[model samples]
Target: MMNEQLLDSKFETEIFNSQIEMKSLFYNLETEIQSNISNLSDFAFESHTDLKQLIISTNVTLQDNLKALQTDIMQQLQQVTDQNLITQAIITDFKSDILNNLSAIATYMNNNQLSMKNNFSFTNSQITNLNTTMQTNFNQVIADVQNTNMNIKNNFTQTNQKIDTVNAQINAVVTNNQFQTQIDLLKQQIQNISVSVSISQSMTSDQYRCLMIAAWYGSYTARDNYFNSEQYLIYLTDSGCPLLKWW
Candidate 1:
């Protein structure tokens, strides 16, 4: 019976020790679980704060970028507007200059046309006057030619009569030997006078014709004593008459 009691006591003591060990292990496991849950919760909260801060920083950066873009856009638009205004002003000035140049060209053309018309009219009148003067000169030349022809015919008739008389005198002198010397001297003197008169007459006729033509053409300038002077007659007979000097 004592043995059975001892066994029962030992069994009871062992069961009690096992129960205490199990209770201690359960308490350690519960403490470890609670610490793990608290650490996880703290880590989650820290991560959420960091994420919020990052989001705030990103939102601030985006806002700043948006403001900068808006400012840049407005500045570009203003520059474009200013350039457009300057371009428009330049175009307007160019148009005004073009119009002024065209107007000046038109005025110049008009003045040139008027000047041409006046010049043409003056030229026509001058040509008409020249034609009339030429016709008058032609008529005068014709009249002078007719008069000269008549004078030449009369001079030829007189020359023929004088030649006949000289021939008769020469024949009579040959027949009369006493008056032969006197007749020979007279013949020599008459030949010298005839040669002088022929030369003088030719020069005078040419000078008179030239003077008439020059007077008709308004190119003759008469000297103070040219009409009836011995010097004037001498000049007409000479070969070196100073027609240009009188002019």
Candidate 2:
């Protein structure tokens, strides 16, 4: 019976040893699982922090670009306004200069027109005065010519009357009876005197007959002398006879 009791005690000791080894293995496996879970959680948290920092940097860059674009647009608008103001000023000055030049030209034209009108009026007055003076001189010349013609007619009438009276006196002398008797006696005496005297050869026959008649009638002084008186004979010849002088 003592041997049997010893064997039962050995079997029980082995079973207890097996149970202790199994419990040790289970504890080691649980510890390894807990360590792997802690590593995974830390990796996820680190990734989240890096993504948030990248988003904040991109937002800051966008805001700075917008501000720069706004500043450039405002400067362009101010430049356009300044150019428009300069163009308006230049146009205003050109219009004012044109108006001044036109006004000066109009004034010069008016002055020239007034001067031409005055000259035309003076020329007309001078022409009228010249015409009047010419008419007056023409009338006076006509009156002077008429007076000269009247004086010439009066002189012609008086000369004709004197000629008629001289003709009547010559006719009376030719018809007298006493003058006929004296002419016959003078003819006889001239014939006798011519025979003795040397008569001038230059005297024509008609001239000698006229001289004897004038001396016998005593129209000029007859000296009481014969044909021998040289002085008396010379006076009769030099007379050329009064009838020739009258004619």
Candidate 3:
């Protein structure tokens, strides 16, 4: 389409140039014929005769040549003028086609833009919905996680309290065992002393009396030392050993 338009413009330019050349040739020929006729007129006037036959013949020949040149110029001008009219028509048609094509392209772009705008609007709506859904799900997930954390914390607290209770019971058991062990040791020592004193009955009187005195003094001092502790007294009673009530 563009190439056709360019060819039309070139054709118009050539036709215009041809018209200019025709006009220039016509003007030059007309000037030459007029100058020759003026010269013939002067010759006739100088001869003082209306029948200047030689100058008249020369003027006739010039007129004929001038007429032929004028005819040729007129024909060329006519052809150029006809082509100019055709060029004008073609230019008008080309302009109309160009305007139509431009209008069609503009309309197409407008429609495409409108479609894109509608699509964008729909896409934006979908994006918004997706974001809303994501946010809602995120909130739900957060709430579930927080609730789980709270439950875990509660479980840990309850477990720690149970562990404390178990520890207290274990400590009580250990303390009771230690007290029983000490009582058993004291009972074993008392049994050994009793066996020794029974076997010493065959000893001399002085040695027997001295051993009894020492045992009495040790028992009296031990009773006075443990009088302030009820647990010690309970342990002694549980061991099957009782203090003598000599006081």
Candidate 4:
């Protein structure tokens, strides 16, 4: 804009200078016309009268032509002035419209910025809430897992205690029972009976049967220790087994 204004001022200055030059040319022409008339009058004879009239007439025509040229120049200058005004008006209106658009754009940006800020705030709030919820849930899950682990540990401890109790009971029953003592005593009695019987290599069948009966009833079992022994004794009296019926 500054450059353009400078160029416009320069153009106007040039036009002013041209107007001054034209005015100077017209003034010089007028002065030369006066000098020529003075020279003609100073030599005026009856024969020079027609030449004087022709010079005067030519000078008037030149003056009229100069006036017409000045009028055209002034009209062109007026047109240039009007064009400059129109251009200035157009530039002013363009500046105003541009300023208005810039203002509107700024306003629009502000409104959108406010809306975006609100949206971001809402999103941030939601994210914060989600994070809090996740933290709570995560903490709860951790507690549940700890509880589960504790329960598992408790159950395993109980199981181990129960196994220990069962092992203690089994050890007591195995170590403190009288069955092995009874079995050893029975074996010793059987050895004593065999040694007594080896006093004779030969024996009657009845005597052998008596010794077998003594081993069966006394060493292996006792009739007085049974609750329902009479039925078995009756069956044994008529037993079909070869060893029981040898007598």
Candidate 3 stretches with Cα past 4 Å from truth are 1-116, 119-122, 181-247
What's model 1's lDDT at 172? 52
The pairs that clash in candidate 2 are none
Q: Model 2 scores what on Cα lDDT?
A: 0.46
Query: For every model shown, what is its TM-score relative to the native structure?
Result: 0.45, 0.31, 0.29, 0.33
Question: How far does residue 32 in candidate 3 sit from its true spot (Å)?
Answer: 99
Write one digit per residue (lDDT tens) for candidate 3, span 1-247.
Answer: 9999999999999999999999897676656544543443343233322223433554475566556655655665565566556555655655565566557557755767776576877645654665676566556556655655565566556556655655565455334343344334443443444544453334345434433433443354334422222453454355443231111
The best candidate in terms of TM-score = 1
Better of 3 and 4 by TM-score: 4
- Model 1: lowest-lDDT 10 consecutive positions: 217-226
TM-score of 4: 0.33
Per-residue alpha-carbon lDDT of model 2 for 208-245, expressed as tens digits?
55545544534322232112224534654566543433
lDDT of 1 by residue, 165-194 (tens): 555654553353433333343334334334
Q: How far does residue 213 in candidate 3 sit from its true spot (Å)?
A: 23
Count steric clashes of candidate 4: 0
Candidate with more favorable, higher TM-score: 2 or 4: 4
